[model samples]
Target: MLLIILGLALWIGAHFLKRLAPDLRARMGNSGKAVLGVMIVLGVVLMIIGYRGAEYVELWPKVQALVGINNLLMVFAFYLYAASGMKTAITRKIRHPQLTAIKTWAVAHLLVNGDLASLVLFGGLLAWAVVQVILVNRADRNWVRPAPVPMSREVMAVVGALVVTGIVMGIHNWLGVQPWG
Candidate 1:
């Protein structure tokens, strides 16, 4: 649990540093970006290790029906994440597609994972995403929505999302976790 908490702290702190202390982040420049990247990666590693090793203290039994819902949400989450990068039509409509995707993904996981460790991991991420969106909106009030892209781009984004989701499911299965329940 300590490691999980530490990881979440590091992840949240590193992300907030840029928003909360813009001057400090700007002063560091590219070096700061590199450091932040490393910190984020390390935080993810710690969270994974901590989550895998932590004892499962079930808060509630997993909802069987939610499993299908979770999977569906995951596909949408992945699509949103991909759309953010591709600047798809949805990007013009959504202010923060990537962050929204994170929230969706976190919520989906939370629905299925009822254990304490899962709660800490997914819930913490969900909180982070929400706070991040708030901070970003506060920082930039005038958001210039991206121009709409061609339909082909939207199709590509959906295809990419499906491929990524399949790969993720494979990885989860490889880790001895059944992604589709």
Candidate 2:
């Protein structure tokens, strides 16, 4: 739990540093990017280790019925994430598709996982995404939406999302966690 909290702190701090202390971050220049990357990677490692090692403390029993919904949400989440990178039509509508995807992913996980560690991990991430979105919007008030792409690009984004979702499912299965329940 301590490790998880520490990891979350590092993750949030690294992410927010640029926004919170723009001058300090700018002063470091490219070196700051490297440091931030290292901090984020280390934070993720600590989170994985902490979460895996933490004793199970259930907040609520696993809801089997929600598994299907969670999976569905996950597909949408993946789609949103892919759309962000592909700059699909959806990206024109959504200013922060990636962050929205993260929030969706966090919510999907929370629906299926009802434990202390899961709460801290997913909930904290969800909060971060929401706050980050707010902060970004505040900073960049005159945001211009991306231009519309062709329908083929939209199709490609969907296909890419599905492929990524499949790969993620396979990885989950390999890790001894059944994502498709």
Model 1 spans with C-alpha error above 4 angstroms: none
Candidate 2 wrongly placed segments (more than 4 Å) = none
Worst 10 residues of 2 by lDDT: 142-151
Cα lDDT of model 2 by residue, 38-133, tens digit: 999999998889998989999999989999999889999999998998899988888999999999999999999999999999899899999999
lDDT by residue (128-174, candidate 1, tens digit) is 99999999999989999998778999999999989999999999999
What lDDT score belongs to each candidate, Candidate 1 first?
A: 0.94, 0.92
TM-score of each: 0.98, 0.97
Q: Looking at model 1, how many pairs of residues clash?
A: 0
Q: In model 1, what lDDT does residue 12 have?
A: 96
lDDT leader: 1
Model 2, CA-based lDDT: 0.92
**Residue 61 alpha-carbon offset, candidate 1, angstroms:** 0.7
